[model samples]
Target chain A: MACFLVPAAEAVITTVASKVMQSKESAPETVHISLDGSTVTEAVKTPFSKKLKWLNNLLWGGSALLAFEHVWHGEVVPWFPFLSAASNPSDAAEMLHEMSTAGVTMAVLVTVVWCGMLAVSNVIENRAVKSAALLPSSK
Target chain B: MTLLTTVFAAIICTIIWYRNAPKSQMKIGILCWMYWGASLMWLVDAVFEYAEIHDEYFTPAPIDMLNDFYLGLSVVALGLIIWLVILLAKDPKGVVKSVLFKKKI
Candidate 1:
């Protein structure tokens, strides 16, 4: 009976959400329009450059996941490139604690970088508003 | 039902209600709120019970705080359901009229 109610209720939410999404589909995609209309800004686009950009973000995300895994499993893979070795919970567990702490540090750093970007955007927006306000009268 | 089971039940209900809610609504609607409140009540009950059973002190984890925030979210979900039933029962015609007009009262 309890399980029955769970699904019964979820169906209701889904029905409502789909209806809302249908409405939103009619709305304009401002972000897509802005990005698509923008002129090329990159200095150079090499195959290596694209690969590095993708790989850098991938590795950063992977590192974060690895750090979180340390909170539970603990080991940071002692036998990465070599032969088999002992895999003890106590041993791996201690190692992971350090890695998880490292993950927290990296996440905090990423957040700070975003905060700086937001500040820059705000400064740019303020200047744009001033420019628009200072437009001369035709008469 | 046991506290843990009840908590599980509430979580399950919260998901159901959330998924059922009108996607167009901005989550503050009655059904969303009701589900949220009920879910939180159960979650806190379960966690407190678990800690008491294990004789463990409450040490806050970031994830735990996040879970607590989820409890807050479910409050709105459960409330939405209550409002849904009320609309269906008390003044069915009026409810339908308002819903058709996209005006929640």
Candidate 2:
């Protein structure tokens, strides 16, 4: 019933982590010096913060949709304990059970998918770098 | 049924993302990923619910089906709203930025 809370909690953590990482992250620059003594600096890659943003976006979006679904079914409400199941001791226990089971499962599944996406993204970035390196230099 | 709805939305978004090609300033990729992830989550939920309910899972009441359809539509709308907010905030193509900063010459 309250499975969305798991991903929502994860999203909150990642969003904070992303902001912290972004603050600490500096674009790694490559310096190139020409024979004429002119030097140029350029950032060579996307930062980890940006990649974390992809995961944040996925988690937040999915959690939002699931939360809306729960709200529609009246499993979630606006006040007090918030979750309808929390109003009762037995239902609260069941809610916790669902959270540990389905909730955790969904969160892990999304994270695994995100990991796969990161792997593919890494491959794409590598390919782009390779192709760019293979190109004839303008110099 | 909700799972199917999300899967359909994901497929449609993916197609649109591909059609847009190199123009990623709008970040359709984010929306596609959202729907895909939601679809996957719901698929797992469906599997679990099926295991719990067995044959009843195949025979959800009409009212429940209708409610699910409504919920599915609302989720799609919410996703679009979230994407729109991101687009407006980022002003990917400078559409909002250009309008807001248009100088009086």
Strongest candidate by TM-score = 2
What is the DockQ for all candidates, taken in turn? 0.01, 0.59
Candidate 1, residue B95: lDDT: 53
DockQ-based class of model 2: medium
Clashes of 2: 0
Give the TM-score comparing model 1 with the true structure, all chains together: 0.26
Query: What lDDT score goes with residue A45 in model 1?
Result: 17
DockQ for the candidate 2 complex? 0.59
Query: Which portions of model 2 miss their true places by more than 4 Å?
Result: A29-43, A132-139, B94-102
lDDT of 1 at B36: 32
Report how far off residue B82 is in candidate 1 (Å): 52
Could you estimate the TM-score for every candidate? Answer: 0.26, 0.83
List, residue by residue over A100-124, the lDDT tens digit for candidate 1. 4433333334334435645675565
Per-residue CA lDDT of model 2 for A52-113, tens digit only, reads: 88888878878888888898889999998899999999999999999999999898988898
lDDT of 1 by residue, B11-75 (tens): 66557656756463332233322333233333333454555666442445677656555543443
Q: Residue A89: error of model 2 in Å? A: 0.5
